[model samples]
Target: MSGQRDRGGYHRQRPPTPSSSAPNMSAADPSNVPDAASARSAVTDTSELVEARRAKLSAWRSQGIEPYGKRVEGLVGLAEARARFDAEVQAAYDEAVAAAKASSSSESVDDPRDRVRVAGRVMQHRDLGKLVFLSLRDHTGDLQATISKALVPADAFELAKRLDYGDIVVCEGPIGATRRGETCVWADRIELACKSLFPPPEKWHGLVDPEHRSRRRYLDLHVNPDSMRTFTARSRTISRIRRFMEDRGFLEVETPMMQPIAGGAAARPFTTHHNALDLELFMRVAPELYLKRLLVGGMPKVFEINRNFRNEGVDRSHNPEFTALEAYEAFGDSGTMMELTESLVHRLAVASAEDRRGEDRVRTGDEDGPILPFGDLDIDYRRPFDRITYEDLFERGAGFSCREIDRVRARAREIGIDEAKLDDWFVVNEVFEHDAEPCIDPARPTFVVDWPSAISPLTRAHADRPEIADRWDIFIGGMEVGPAYTELNDPDVQLERFEAQLRDGGDDEERTFRSLDRDFIDALRVGMPPAGGLGLGIDRLVMLLTDRASIRDVILFPLLRPASEAGVE
Candidate 1:
């Protein structure tokens, strides 16, 4: 249950056998040594290159050159440095070399290999004995650096020969083309930015094992560069969401996670005891009640994007602690929330693929296109998503209207519902979820509105029909993205709803936390505004926008079976 374990911050490289190295392992010792501060790493079973690099750290310190490095100014990214390489400048240098080679009588022009500074983690360093091809990576991207025997001072050139794969280094080089026309930096000066003893992941395969990858995401991100891109896109999506809400004057706020009672949704809660108070507190199941309190306090518009904990199942779509974006608007109801939900989602989808011109998942081409792939399916966020009523969808699925009690009861019995022992609404909900839910179109986002009044306890009854509630759930790619509600503001009705929930039980799990939500009803009694509320699962949205499948994929540190990972099943 503890998530404090290291998530692969260190990947130690295995050592090459002494039999494969020079005849005497100690004979090739260079003066580049580590300081007392940067002592030889504690892990003994590391690669020969890693141990050699450690020796260099101690050797460098002996010569007053700190192997770990210091704060040197003027560091540009490796990608930015690579972008500065001009074909004309390289061509001119080639002409100068040609002229000098043609006749010793001709005056040679200045060689393009000169001073320029860059910094990055040493991603790859293949020792060719006479030549070194080192790939360095920063946040921007990875770029190759070439070190040749003829291009550097003898001592510095030898340092390049022994550079380890994970060391961070700052190189002063001139960018140019290789013999095959691949762009690279030819460095005349190289200094240790930071010495890394860790062994990187497999060069070509990257991080493939899910458990290893999740546990060591840093290595995964570095090894598989595309992983970072997914997280980066996640950040962009959240930013766009915030901007969309803020631009519409919605105030963002925070709420309590540890509460006396978990009141927002029907689910089991993680219970803990407050030592001082000797009182039981449950981790927040939702921010609904608290968000509604803000509506009572006269904040006309508000939203919160935060985590909620539930002591329940962990699956591809559900995590113990998940992020949710909930918003409330005064003087609004389900209709208002519907409009806001559509606009917010559509804008985010449009913004997500706005930079893409092609019909692919990754952004490319026109930068104004609307195609973002989600698991082999390219979702079009060009316009408003499809909308349908809950009854209509259920009717389409069950082959009869939900209002026909006889058909509903018959279908429920066939679908494994024990009708003789179940309440009408519960049976109906079970049937709807089991049958109608599958009818949703997987590609187009759809909202199923006007739920039965019995199931939607927190929502207001429909203005046109008292038997139905003003609630709607937005489904995209066969997943529930969000739900909107025209809230019940009357204190008496709110209290009645909460009390009624306690009277009706779904199963043991729901019974554990489905008590009368007194505090929320109390807030309602204090004159809460008639409001529209919306709850969006931010992590799921990020997963949708980024095309990540598991809820754990988007979460930085997801809950996992213990590393002693035995019988999780």
Candidate 2:
């Protein structure tokens, strides 16, 4: 098979099987063949293919050329090089060449085409005897390089002709368009950047297997344009969030990633030992506690975008490690946090809508509200996101009031939840999660406010209703995007709630990570202001905006099962 690589640096190849046939190699000495190849016929075909690439590596070494490349000066990216192509410059150069030819003089005419030096991995290569054409790709985009044997040095031309599909190359040339209307670089000089020892994937069917894509993401990034674009959008999305927050007088901050007690959230934490201190530590499940500590330290407004580690099961929406954004504002309550969240999400949605236009995706064409597509749903991000009370939704969904202990227990048991072991409010919350959450409109941004105080240990109790907390959870595209709280700042109340949570007999997994943070209670006792706090799932938010289905899709390098573990599948 001809190995013609392209910007999508892969070619199709089935893993060698026992029934596969190997092509005869005339240049390979029979005695020099690996004994394992003859011993195990199943690997013979793969061995032969590998041997061919290895031979090229040997030849390059014998010619005194390094297989790897060094930093080359004055080299531009492929996209930048392509951008330098100008129609007027090419026409002028063409006219000058024509005039020189007509005069029949030995004098050379000044070339008007823009000159650029560029480098990238060879995507496509064709050797047409005296001329060679190579397509190169960088992160920005791809460009074609046309190397003429008559124009370039003899040695450079020879190198171009023999270059393999995956080899990286640097070339200098005048930016011009081909006769067939393809923009290209007409190379006067070329150099080998690196010699690739492995064959690239098949050009027509590049790294298609999803499992293979995640495992070998390096290849996927080069081959899959969609993947590169997804990550680019993700980066821009994060930067926009940072800028948006900074412009609103919020100071970005960093918090300790490891803590003696995982006090932020109820999620299980990954544990580790600090050998020097002879003490144990857990990777922070959330930066909430520390961010609040900053508020206690006189920071009026603060936010952090960072990684949090949790011991959790993997799913389309969940990762063991994920990014979260936490913010705290002094003298603010749940209502204040709600307003901030609405403004931030709406702004991001508008930005994403503009980005969708750039990506050429279908738009709803409603300028009054920017609608972004998330899977099959077109989520509208108009002003005044729908807000409903937790009690109202639970009453409607469960067909009973949230305070109905008997009905809540019956519903929990019907859903196969063990109501006997858990507390009454816990059972009610379980029923609400199973029934009430699904009632939310997937096509609209919503906030479910006024959660039960018992379920929100860190939130302030409602002034009128002692059983309900002044809290709200934002949902979009059927996912809980984030939660906001009028934080509990009273030291005695906070301590009482912490003790109640510890005695709540949470599941074994939850109980393992649940513990009191004495220092955090001490911070509360130091007279912190009544404030609002928020924690958002940044990855999930990006997934909604970018139309990515899974958290893994937006994550650059998601945690994956080992190859050996995968082979068993």
Candidate 3:
């Protein structure tokens, strides 16, 4: 990939054309780069933010103040800052400050300002003669800080006045309340924490541009407190999941992300070359096969919570890469995995409700799940999630069970499934999606079980019912969150499934890696214990738990195009 100049003056990797850059437009007029002329021309650009910060930085520097500050550790969180507030203490303190100013002869006097140290990005600042008010924000939350000239040293008070919003500042102050009862730290000592060279996003709307927010999430996180909370909740949710899995005795393990064959799922791989080894490697689409292999290797139980790369489209729900958790147990079957998935998701929902404030969880942002609002519907992740077989759901949705081939085909035609041309399974999936999928309560984390054997290549078929595979997909908020599979330990059966998949037009590239899982079979031939496996979409889970509508929101650095940035030659 070659680097191309983006609109943000950042280098974005583009198709390898040539190292040559787009001719420097700035060479014609360096002064135009940050001038009002350029700014008005592209007011949409974040450079407007940069320019604003530059002006503020200049003003502060002219006043002999550093726009960027020094190292100041031991910053207290907003929640902690709020804890220091005391109504009675603050009233007395305010009186003390008033008296100190009025009593010129008063030599020694008691001051009631709360003495505490905290550091944060300056979000809001107001200086009123002998007093200053500021809003300090950190990952935990935000609070107001007040500095009175009479309380802080003369130099410190001056520093407080010179402080610009977005600058990092550390202040030692007494915790008290403003007359309005807003919790505030009364500053006695102030120090520069760190200088922000760039201007912040719109203080009111913050970083509202989706593209910019994704590109410079660090800026978004600081500017938008809600963004920080979303990410923080995502982390805590993952942490809780790990604890849940571990408590259930699932041993976590790392697997080879680079594989000779990306055979586990029907998704494109991110291919890369190992120059030294001269071997092609693929970013795994799923850790399913490896985790299953671990079960075969006598690991008894194993799980991998990691990433899977799917070279696919970008949408509200899709990303090129995303996190997943895949687990396998030696003696469990699909039913076991089903139970585990349900309990896990239920626990997550309960925990999220507990962690969130207001009605976001209980009311739901979406109408699909429980009463807990999802996008618009309250997603109900409550226990005993709805369960319906593929046939049952299809029958209800298509007005005929999947077994009613003729009607299924007719419905498919009506739905543009082209049943007359495609494979039986393809047509089945088509109607299943448009029709059957809608039958499940999107608000309920429901599982549609027993997929058609053709689509579930790796899943085992019910002995009594070879037409239906022992598999299930769990859906919530109109998205498939994960799937569960009963183990197929018979090598001969496994080989048959693989061969049938190839015969179905999965060409050479796929066969090379999908080739009969001989080693897996060998393990099965060793009389391995039957097991159930589960693969979960961790990012999507985070999105649900954090109430982020798009998969991109929960993701830290979703891939994006670098905006064209102009610069001086």
Looking at candidate 1, the ten consecutive residues that score lowest on lDDT are 3-12
Using lDDT, rank the candidates from best to worst.
2, 1, 3
Which should have the higher lDDT, number 2 or number 3? 2
RMSD of each: 7.6, 6.3, 5.4
How displaced is residue 20 in candidate 3, in Å? 17
lDDT of 1: 0.78
- Candidate 2 wrongly placed segments (more than 4 Å): 1-47, 95-106, 362-369, 395-414, 420-424, 508-513, 565-569
Give TM-scores for every candidate, taking all chains together and pairing residue i with residue i: 0.87, 0.87, 0.86
| lDDT of candidate 2 over 1-569, digit per residue (tens) | 11122111121122335664544422244553333334444332354666777887787778776667689999888888888899988888888888889998789888878899999888899898998999988888899999998999887887899888888899998999888878999999888888876678887688788777787788888888778878888899899999989998999999999998887788889999999999889999999989888888999999999999988899989989999989999999989989988999988888878767744443533565578878888888887999999999998798899888998898898999989977777888999999999999998999999998878889999889998999999999999989999998999998988898787646777887678998988998887899999988999999998898999888988998755422121
TM-score, predicted candidate 3 vs. hidden true structure:
0.86
Clashes of each: 17, 8, 43
**Positional deviation of 551 in candidate 3, in angstroms?**
0.6
Residue 109 miss distance in model 1 (angstroms): 3.3
**Top lDDT hit:** 2
- Quote the RMSD, in angstroms, for model 1: 7.6
Model 3 global lDDT (CA atoms, 0 to 1): 0.77
Alpha carbon lDDT of each predicted model: 0.78, 0.84, 0.77
Tens digit of per-residue lDDT, candidate 1, span 289-337: 9999999998999999889998889899999999889999999888898
